[model samples]
Target: MSRTSTESVTPTPAVARRHRLPGKALLGLFLAGFVSILTECLPAGLLPEMSRTLDTSVSLTGQTVTLYALATALGAIPLARATNKMPRKHVLQLALGVVAVTNTLTALSDDYLLTLVIRFVAGLGTGLIWPLLGGYAARLAPAGRQGRAIAIALAGTPIGLALGIPVGTWLSGLGGWQLAFHASAVATIATMAWAMATLPNLPGRPAEARFTISQALVIPGLRTILFALAAYMVAHNILYTYITDFLSHAGMAGQTGWVLFAFGVTSVLSVLVVGTHIDRHLRKLAVGSTAVFAASVLVLALFTNAPVLVYVAVAAWGFAFGSSPSLFIGAAINATGDAADVAQSVTITVFSASIAVGGLTGGLLISGLGTASITWAALALLIAAAATVIGGRKHAFPRNS
Candidate 1:
């Protein structure tokens, strides 16, 4: 949990007060965060190949994803609370190291249960380190630039989401599923090395800022927005959880690989475009793009049975969900002010919780109502997100909090 050298090697009290991160170092921080996210999701993209090797059915192979999500959801709060005082540099290194070691273990394991355990551990590492990394990114920025800095760091999430799956899929297709973890292990290791050499000491600690659960919970306008985000995410996760499954069942199996490829390509593009925009115009962007998300979901729900629309829906949904990281983090930062880290962790937890809920919701919706139900629920949630964004904007104040 070591911090960057800014705090540890200040020339004087005044200089210490003025210290900030270098440009390359800041970029390195964003890369580190992105790499960690990629490592966290590596197992998910390779689940099918992993299933064949683990001798388990794909449904059970899916447990690794659901449970990894659950673990991250449960682990976020305490990890944020406990590590607030730890050195920023050490925390990052530890997180990256956890990814590296567990990925190696996953690559080496033959047992499915053991592999599941490894994924859980890797998720835990993500929960423990990610909040701090996000908080520190904002802290590392100059006073007015927190929004821009956070947007850059958040871009990592999409980078991870977009790259990890494709890379894992390609590697697994070329060799075995194990190659995915090998690549993850190598990526995280390199990230760890770079983080050790870079990453600045964060200047603030949101967990300790007010030091009260109630206070953190009562962050300005947090409840409505958090729940809105959580709800949308849950719905999104449910739809996404069984995307490949549904496509296969719907006779789009032949195009599944292309769908994923298109989704990845579009996701990266959305992140690049929207992440920065969210930073500068939080309210406008949040309100404007929300319908885009809803429309994307609704269209997919109706047209998923069509080959062309199926591809379009997947790519569009990718764009919609891909823009979330920056918006959510920005909302939290706006709400929490000095408590940006804790707030960010809460968003992560909410996000992770949504994934877990999404899986359950998707499964039940698909089973009880039908696969089409998934889109309706997802669209409903996205509408809620839009409402929340609109509502928050209406009531928003200069509460730099």
Candidate 2:
């Protein structure tokens, strides 16, 4: 994946001249991503209620998230490949349909094992959704503005974390844990319909144009980007997965929604900032986001005695993390050029796997070392991730990007 590989995929000047974002299609993708993430993390904010209702320990309940990520990681590459020749719009609609159905079933399930199965299927839906979104946004974007288009499209992740989870927590308080899932199902269904009407029905990859997972993996800078993505996502999830428990431990049990809301507000700001600067300063944004995240965790590790400090740290964390998917997937695409879709599938696989690792790691840390240790652990991982991003400047996150 040389610079020439990147240049090869750049839109011609004529195409660039007319390039403008397909706002309706991108918004449809945004909502699809929003629903997918909202479904995935809804349980985080309602863990205790879900645990009690399911007759399982909180740790075991957390595996719902882990299992979902594991399913996504396991399925992304194969599913993306399988659907390569299908209509892109149809593939998205199908995936969104599965998400809606599975989330509804999850809301109805009384048996923990049954709920796990439902969530697993939902994860498969998201596996497809994640890989498609970046490429889909790129396809719909005008020539030079693909970065901004992708930023808008992927904004749903942070929004889901920032607003969706907190809102779900509030709704669970008014109704029950199941209400969040029901809401997610309704939202997903609506998004699917919006996509059908608004999104372009692009043709899928022709056989000769398709690239394999192995081929995507072998791209020079791709593995570095994946490694950094894994580190960043795992660290984020360690804290994110068990956020409610961590808050309770820190004596902010009643402030979970508020805290997350604050995080969400800044996360939106992050998207705005990244969208503005990503195309010209991709390397700087990558380094800066990782470094900022590490610093935020360090604050979390050392300053929980003050609630204001905690809020500030968390807001910073959200700002740092909000644009990560956009940054990483963008980097991967730049690296893999014409194989951008395949690269996206591989990136999503690593991203999902990291979530699983983070959830499992967070659970273990809570059981063994306790919640306080999670921040420290996350801090260390962020440090390593930042180092990788900083050192890989020659390729992975090239300064020129």
Candidate 3:
């Protein structure tokens, strides 16, 4: 009898073994993600209080938020590489400790400089945990379960966006920005404690497979994937940063908060949808959804002023925003053969840079040009990203590479 290719290839004993992550480890991973992101998004809701406490303009305080994004982007590459030799659990635990302490410093500061300094340190620590979790998630998940595992971990994005800002604002109203950081520190510490007890070491590669940050960046598929994902990210975040302001400008001033609430819920649902579906058709999902995402951005930009149209635009953006993160995660894992963490670190480094440039430029663009101009800029980014997706279909990424 002739053997078919599918039947000829035999599975090794290691490949055939049943695998599952322990329940407690999964919870610890998700909690680590939740707190790490809260440290980023919480300050968004507390920006007004940050201004008063630091004796700066609300706009200047907004730069602190941008600073975290900037630092995190630049920091991810070197920090991720440096920690390659360390235990995954130790690196993350150390990073969280820094967050806890730095967050505490921000709470105690009466001086503006002290607050900024503490935030800067906290931002670097914040950078380390995200990619570590990516690596950790890849390691912890069973062979066929990486997507859902990552989704469960990545939910922190929307949850942080949904809970962090609103809760921080609510907390600030009751106590102050200082209290908000105190709460942040408490959360960070608790996550670290849980991680120390729960997360596996997720062993490092055989020496032959190990690569440096420079080597990782040189791979063609990895580079292209990062560029495309970054372009998509830059556009999405630029639109996201000014959404609340856009809602007000669109003449829905009183109902903007409700619009934001709608976005959060829709965004969470979108994340779940993508997390569930991406595995079966990653290429189509990345391309089609991104096209839809781009189209919605265009629609939002041109029709923002119609009150009824504004809600629809917000939900569209929310859904896209939710789906994009997981899509990018799936893309990164596909691009790098076995080093999803390395791929994740590279992806986020690009993501961070995209965010930094988008945030700073969008702020300036809004100030000098207008909100309409900001959307035009984002439209250009999306157009470029759409082109990349077209090219990617011809030269698929290294799925395990």
Candidate 4:
């Protein structure tokens, strides 16, 4: 899985010569990425309503988020490996179908346990969708355009985070939290149909060897990125999973949607900035964004009562955190080269696990200590992540393109 091997496969000669770049297909992938993330993060906005309606504690309700992430983490590698030889279009369609069905079930279910079960099923779909989409985006990209293609495809995530969660929260306010899930199901169904109609048959290349998780771990650069990514995600999720609650506690309960919306907007802006330069300046972008993120968390921790400061902090947090997945995934792809799918699978697994860890940790902290404690704990992790990035600067971020 050397860089040469990876570069050679990114836009295989057959792929580049046989087909023009499929703009609509990439759009479908983008939508798939969008819907997948929307499904995963919808719970964050609805945690309070869910807790009350389900007759569960807030911490317990937060576990719904934890459950989804854990399921995704647990399932990502096996599913990625199992479907490695299949056509990506079919795999994507099936995964989106799973998302649609499970979310629909979640919308209709009244039982907390049942909803959790359905959410976990939806996680399986997301776990499959991410790596497949990453690889698919790379495959469809013209030679030397893989980074831009990935940036375009991954734009779905920030959109979902920026627009979807806040909008869902607003909709939940108008109707109920179930409305969010129902809306997600509808969106996912439409995206699945669009993908089915639009995505070209992307047959698996049998000549390309499949790389295992063990193989990916053996690469020091990939390992370092994964470690930093884990810490970063854990820190971010700790604050993120309970943001609505944090706002509510600060007497700004009615403003959660607007605050989150502001966060999302800056996130999109930051990701766009990263997209333009990520291919050439991966390490600098990663380290700088992370440093900004830590500083934002520190602001939130220290100034919990200042409305102006809070808004500014949230925007800063959104900008840095929103740009993260693309930069980190790009790092992984760069590290693994030809073994991009394996690297993606591992990245998703670590990402999911860290989300679960963060969510659970926040829940425990909120239950026992306090909400402000989450930011402090998160800040510590972010500092560690920054350290990892600086320490591994030379070896971890070699130019892949």
The 10-residue segment of model 2 with minimum total lDDT is 1-10
Cα deviation at 158, candidate 1, in Å, is 2.0
Weakest lDDT window of 10 consecutive positions for candidate 1: 1-10
**Which candidate number maximizes TM-score?**
2
Pick the lDDT winner.
2
Q: Candidate 3: where is the Cα deviation over 4 Å?
A: 1-23, 206-208, 394-401
How much lDDT does each candidate structure score? 0.72, 0.88, 0.73, 0.82
lDDT of 3 by residue, 251-349 (tens): 776785687787888878876787665556566666766677778778878887677776777777777677666667766776666666677887777
**Candidate 3 similarity to native, TM-score:** 0.89
Cα RMSD (Å) per model? 5.8, 3.7, 4.3, 4.3
TM for every model, in the order presented, reads 0.87, 0.93, 0.89, 0.89
Ranking by TM-score: 2, 4, 3, 1
TM-score of candidate 4 on Cα atoms, chains taken together: 0.89
Candidate 4: residue 98 lDDT (0-100): 96
Q: Candidate 3 has which clashing residue pairs, if any?
A: 336-401, 337-400, 337-401
